[model samples]
Target: MLKNKGKRAYRVLDFLHEHVIAIIIAVVVLAGVISTIAIVKGDVKTSSEKENSIQYEEMSTIYFAMDPVKSLNPLSSQDRDVYYISQLMFSSLFKLNENLNIEPDLVSSYTANSGSGTVSIKLREDAKFSDGSRVTAEDVRYTVSQILRIGDESPYYEYASKIDSVKTSGSYSLTITFENPNDAALDNLVFPIVSSSSYDDSANKIVGSGQYAYDSYDSMKLLKLKPNTYYYGGVPQNRIQFKIIQDKTKTTGLMTTDAITAYVSTAQDADSDAEDKKLKVTKIPSSELEYLGFNFDNKYLAKKEVRQAIALAIDTESLIQDNYGGAGITSDSVYFPGFLGTENKGDFYKQDQKGASELLQKSGFKDSNEDGILEDSKGRDFQLTILVNSNDGSRSDTASSISEALNQIGIKASVKKVSWAEYRSEVRSGDFDLFLGGYQFDKKYDLRSLFSKSNYLGYKNDQILASVKKLETCISAEQQKETYEKLKTMLQEELPYYSLCYKTYSFITVKEFTSTETPTFFDMYRGCDTWKWKKVVVTEQKDDE
Candidate 1:
């Protein structure tokens, strides 16, 4: 048996030896196939892992201050904080620039026909509401209706009353009929436009077409906003959060506590934040006009040449630099710079003492007794008194400067710094020759009623009336600009009032952010979409055991 087993084993070994190469090759080929499958599986996994990997995204946010409990209705809310916040959540057909110029907003093109008392406006086709509804002619008309229904209670009542009616032709086409031919429809139509489809039920929801959409709000705490997806401007990772505090006086404190990001204020003094925590500021030119007025009822002041000579003698640039903290601008008129009438005009009221002296010499005025004081042809001394509010140090100082200038010109001039009551009484009674005063006009820049204002200056001029008539017929922007030049010329000839400067307000931000266009009161968030901001991180140290 052992011999047979050995012989079989030997025979199997001999057969295996003869085909050893084929066995080895078969083993290697099997290993290669298995390894190839494993490699293919590994490559598939690597590619799938790479395809699924992605960079995370972050949403940007802004924190601001507003009245917590007050209504956020843009049309009726009188709170300035509410007004400013509404600028973020609302859209207007027109917007005011930093220079107070009327610029198109929702409207792509507009044309006014003073002869027909109608204004045709073509809305931007891309315009939409926060609710993703297309902004239509009906929405504009509906907004005007709301403003009208609010009546005098709304801050926009004056502007809304100028529109006789709003008619819609198509989704983006509309016409506004003014109550009067001379009314500036483009200026008056700047009121905020809300969604007509939702306004009946969502008036208190603060929904409108703006840079941001309302996401959440707590009356006592905060108002959260989400991006308006329907907005065609651009898709950004931005959000807006409004901190609701009761008192306007607490904005600076909230900012100091790192609870808010930015705010709009009259000046740096308005913010009570610590000096170490400084804010980046952007100045907004206001429609407030600080001017020097003349009472034409005065005997010698009634003369055109005397008023012209006095206007030339007053040094406006020096007064603005000294008394105004160099924060104001001297437009050629009582109207604001870049306003309707002063857009293209030069600095006509600059100090020209030589010209003033020459004009005085030609106007039959002389120092009769060589006492250094000039007397009129009737032997009357060139005497005047400037009235100013005693409490307003800036105006008082400006009045004093004017008095000094008049005295330097050999005239007996003095400043009458009186109490508020006395100043108001004198101004209303027209009992003074000259008064230092200011007017805070709305975004429309309409001061036409000043032309007929009685007990103020007693200024009556037929040329002014004619110029106003001409301005009424202006329909296009070019025509308005041209007609305003005529009105400026008339004002120059009459010289009823001399413009000193327009006050400017400050907008402070926690981060270094800039706007695409100069900021204005009506549209402070004009270019907020592109506003680059950085989060201010504050490190707080806790107790260590």
Candidate 2:
């Protein structure tokens, strides 16, 4: 048996020696296959773990108000809410920063020829629409053409009317010629640009080169916006969801619940509940100029002395405090506080009842009767009716206060609170002696609409008109500044309109978010991209044995 086993071992050794190279190749191949399978299984496990970790992390969502938007069409809509949404979803040739200064949006650079009244805008090569298509000068020309076609119906028509022609200089450059030189021509170009091929004049959905793209609007209740991957600007992390709740009461209620992440409200609307909910309230200086517009056609108001006296009799500080809840800044000029032409002209026409009375007396108004009411040369009592929009509680209160103050000064004044429609009709028709109205001025600072001969006030001064025309035509900022300074002095002396105050607005957000710096009406989301989410991460403890 030992000999037979020895012979078998010897045979096996000989067979192994003969096939050793082939066996070695087979073993190496099998080892490589096993190693590859192990590596693939390990990679799959690691990928699954990474994906699960990312899925477990929460993505932040931001909610804003969309109730005020009536239409999404940039050319047709003038609603503030619509403007805000357009700012997000549509890219303009230019945009205003937090300082309210015009900056380039789609244009990489621009050149203006003041002598020729032409502007050439060079588009960025990489600027693209939401659909990843390149933005061209033809798109801008098409937008301007559409705005012009709308005529006076579009808010941008005024700007469009200034353009004599829009021609594409190149694939990425556009040259626009104006009929006349305009200092605000670049400022007027801030209107949004839409894709020429996509627009159907339907106001359905907007497609542009803005930072965001329209996703969906659910029956006017909610508006969903997504970051545009093709945006010239980088994409943001949080998705924006705007809730359209028109009722202020309902909006306030949503603030307490998690339904709304942020809301905008007046300071007066920031109640205790907002505090309990730990909302951070931010105040923004409004561009809305609340002033007392006089019907210059009125016999009494047509007299500069009468208007100046009325301006001096009322206390602007007291009126702002009592009527506006001290939520407004006193304004002495038609321009807003930070506007280019705004200045302190030694507080002209301040509350000076004695001066007002002396001025009235010098103007040939006297108390002919013992009734203590001033009368003109014809012995007619100087009774002026002050009209206020009934919809605006603050303006109505201010009108009442002005009437009381005038009555105290022996000038018979009465308050007439009229509906908004009626107030507009009366003011437009010059049917009121005095009216408490507010004007939300555009960034252009064009006063032609308020001071021209065809204006509601019928106020036309040759020197003033000439100054305004010069300011519009002025080529350089220095020249514009010099002209505006002279215009300001003239406006102060003439007292065409009593520039009362600039209103303020309040915005409410969760305590986790910080308020934007120097927010304006046009750029409410100025710093929204920098908003941080205070998220907390939790980890499970491991058992140690």
Candidate 3:
């Protein structure tokens, strides 16, 4: 019966095809008939009945925000907040490509000048700044000179510490002489270029030869940017909006309303918004590690047994999974995952409640009050105040979980959450026995701040310090790995900061945009150059009428 019905339908279609115009008209009518049937069957409807197609060409404004301070001139070199902006709006001789590999941006080619303490660079003749000024060797010379004169205040100061001088041979060639000959010099040259003409007054005019130019600025709330058509590389799609909408709820709301297209620092909140079906969430591995610093300055924390007991009592994995909803990787060492220093194949810490009880008992803690809480042999309860920056709920919740775990082992713990500014003050003043903190690794991967005598924790181990210095000068990758491994082992033993977890950084965008997981301020709009709104097609089956 089905085959005979198909044969009759084929015969009718063949007769319709025999008359071309009639077939066209008949197909149009058939399409209308199918459309009516689809409507009746509740399978297809007018697009106006559904969500409006996402606006694509109307200045695809992406609101990108970060938890950062307002301003520091890029020329200052030391300020990340400023460097991040500089990286986007400006270009350097060397640039990191999508694969995170070094590539040329302003300069066409480079060669190491052996024995001359210099690296010779050949500039791309056509490269010109947004102001229509030709990017010359003098620009590089002047930028390096400004960084040297600016000293420690510049974001590039540490990177520039190797540069003895920058000499321009001609309009298109430059020589970068280093104070110390190191292989990292080539990598450090990736510093964003600033116009020599504006170096003295760079804070006002941050002109460069990059994808976008500074369009407008708010006192501290925002920095608006527009595409620079004169850009030597790929042109950006639309005006870039950098907003400081720090409130998580406000950020989520903006994304839902299409007021913003991208945001930073909200893995916890983005997860909540993913259910809306209009948003896309991605977790990317970042070189960020959160830690709990144990105060070496405090008499109670000076005891190694006390530190070990606390470490054993705190269940970092459970804290990360339960409180943070598994948004991060449980850290066993100081270095974050994907970093070279990360001790991937080693065992650092594991949960053991029985072991924790034994460690506490050995540390001379007794349950003297008949309550579950343990006290020192002197009947002093093992209680301490934990301080964390109040802005992060995930960190606060992790702290609360740690507190609960410690209580399980008879250690009483309380949390003290404070404003970020106050938290910084507390960290610097050595006012807390324990504090929740995180570190952003410098280009050199320096751990000096954490173990140096100048550190907030006042934790100093001679061997660890020696190993760090060795880690700096070691040229061989194997030697470097050994030194880093040794340092990690020692740091874990010292327990300066009970390494908590490496949190995943997320960048959430709407379905209309295409973005990459690894973000770079230097080329924030690199993805935008080719991005176009794709019309998503949804098809429905028509019912026979």
Candidate 4:
């Protein structure tokens, strides 16, 4: 038995030695498969973690002093705050840059027929709505039609009123014909475009083609905006959050406490202490014209001599020095400084008390009762009330100053402070004798609203109206300049409104959100896409072991 066991062991050893190479090959192949499976599983796990670990590096918030009064719908909203936000959420056929030049936005290119008074716009194929739908000519046509249909109810009616017809030739091309040859037709096309389906229902959900889309609005307190992935301009890196605070006093506190990252204000709202804390304040000349409008229908103001006398009595230089700290540019022309019409520099009306008195006396106004107040021809005291909007302190102060100045010149004047709504109603209804107001002119400098026969002041001058008509459709730069110069001379003589100063707006932001571009009043977020937040991110890596 021992001898047979020994023989079996010897045979087993020989067989093992002969198949060693085949066994080694099998083991090596099995090990290779197992190692590949482990490596793939590890890679999948790392990719999943990386995909799920995205975190916001930084966040930004902006604080606006005024809250939007109505919905964010560009067509229906009349508030300036709404306009600012709408520019972010919607895209227009054209956009006014910081230089106030009209640049293409939604429209890739356009052609204007000067003789035909028609503009052909071709929509960009890449432009898309927030919902990822391609922006078509139908959307542009629908937006303009809605504005026209709403008439005066729509805030954009004034801009679109001249658009006689909007006809689309294809899905991406449209032509806009004007009732007359208006040189400002292209400028007026800056009105924002909405998705054609936005008006399908009564709800105010505005889907636009801008970089940002409306995320939510908590009444007057807050407005949250998110990036639009389909934005043709590319999405901004940081989301924008607008914190609306009607009280201007709390704005500084918000900035100091880091509750808000940015604020847009006038120069009067700037604080030296805030600047010490790395807050940057930038001032830009605004196109807003603050003036005093006269009711031409009033018997006392109807006379050209009386209106001119009043214009001469008020010291606009002192008004600017005292109220604006000599930081504004004063003008007598209806157009703001740097505009085409302002080149004439109508220096007819200046602070000349003697000249004012002479004009008043020639107009048959005298101190009949010797009570320091002038009397009209009929022996009635010459008293006028200057209405001012209570919300604007600078205008209110101007009204008071004018009242005091007029009283010194033997004219009894008073100031009436009223709410903005009441002020508008009174002016529109021709219920006020004189009022302090402001107007934002279009880039084309259209003066029809202030100088035409059917104007806000109920003014009617046939010659001025004709010049305005010619200015609107002149198309020739030289002719337009000549017409505006003539119109400015006529305005200086007429004295329908006393142009005081063009306002300036200051924007304050933290150092972390720095950008090279400066924003203008018309386009506050002009280069918002380039704004960046200062932050660092750390990403974890998988172990190779």
Which candidate gets the maximum TM-score versus the true structure? 1
**What local distance difference test score does each model get?**
0.75, 0.76, 0.69, 0.76
What would the TM-scores of all predictions be? 0.79, 0.74, 0.63, 0.63
Estimate, for each residue in 61-155, the C-alpha lDDT of model 1 and write its tens digit: 76777775467778888777677777777778887656555678898998877787888899999978887789999989998898888899787
lDDT of 2 by residue, 506-527 (tens): 7666555653353566676665
How would the candidate models be sorted by TM-score, starting from the highest?
1, 2, 3, 4
lDDT of 4 by residue, 36-71 (tens): 787778743533344324333565544344564666
User: Candidate 1, 494: how far from true, in Å?
Assistant: 3.4
RMSD of each: 19.0, 20.3, 11.7, 20.5
Q: What would you estimate as the lDDT of candidate 3?
A: 0.69
User: Which 10-residue span in candidate 4 carries the lowest summed lDDT?
Assistant: 46-55
Question: Which residue pairs does candidate 2 place in steric collision?
Answer: none
User: How much lDDT does candidate 2 score?
Assistant: 0.76
Candidate 1: stretches off by over 4 Å: 1-59, 108-111, 170-172, 201-203, 235-237, 246-259, 268-278, 340-347, 453-455, 466-474, 536-545
Q: What is candidate 2's TM-score against the reference?
A: 0.74
